[model samples]
Target: MSTDTTTEPEDASLEDLLARVDDLETRLADLEATPDDSQKMVVVATKGTLDMAYPPLILASTAAAFGYDVTVFHTFWGLDILHEERSSALKLSSVGNPNVPVPNAIAALPGMDEVTTRLMRKRIAENDVATVEELVDLSIETGVDLQACQMTIDLLGYDEDDFFDGVTTGVGAASAFREMVEADVQLLV
Candidate 1:
């Protein structure tokens, strides 16, 4: 004779199951009605050239305007973007940039970077586009968190006072990583 192994379900009545379902539905509806958390955006700015500086600032400012919590983590060359004096004096690299419209040979000339920067500044002025300094100011005013990497600061021999007024200097990479990990949108520029 074969052993009878089939077991009936636990004594869960229809009304009990329906009540549990109703409770779960109520909880789901309450959760659905709750407001969503704010979105977060993080950008890692690794370039300090005049041309390279715009993207992170622009994006950060725009995201802030859209009600996103925005952070721009400046590391390596990007630390210059937060430097009060250097930000304004950032120069466009004439060599190895395809958008410069100059051949690499010609762009490598001694004064070509200065010339390119001058021309670009002129074009920007003519077009009424904001300068790097102006964009940095705007980013600060718009509540974009500007974080300067601590290790880079030590390596480059930069003091905390070297950065702009609103910049958060001496931030470590691990802190930046935490922010990036929690960010809804992350970019490396």
Candidate 2:
């Protein structure tokens, strides 16, 4: 003869498990109803070049237009995009850019960057594409958060006044990281 020794959870333990599940479901419903339900995007801009500047700004503005909460964190050389004066005068470098038809030898020549920038500007105008300044303005008007890194600003000796009117200057990396952590989309440009 054989005896079965299987055991089941106590009735009290099963009741406790059901109660915990109920609490969890209630908390989840509350979270789903909160304002945090909106989609979020965080874009990290680390390059200052004119060509490099467009991607982040365009993405941020587009996301904002689509009703997503968007934040652009500009650090290192990327801070130039927020600089009121520098942004307007940004130039595209032909050197080391594979897209440019010019050979590296000729691209390395003096004034090539200026020529490339002029050509790019003409193309943008011909295509009726918005300039960097216009995109920045639109992003601001659409409520996209443009944050400039405090460390980069201090390192470059830039004052808050140097940035555009709506830009949030002197923001720390930690704050940007917090936003990134909560964002549904994170981009490093």
Candidate 1, superposed: residue stretches over 4 Å from native? 1-36
Best by TM-score: 2
* lDDT score, candidate 2: 0.92
lDDT (tens digit, per residue) of candidate 1 on 91-111: 989898898888999999999
Candidate 1: pairs in clash: none
Residues 79-121 of candidate 2 have per-residue lDDT tens digits of 9999999998899999899999999999999999999999999
RMSD of candidate 1 to the truth, in angstroms, is 5.2
Each model's lDDT comes to: 0.91, 0.92
Q: Which ten residues in a row have the lowest lDDT in candidate 2?
A: 1-10
What's model 1's TM-score?
Answer: 0.81
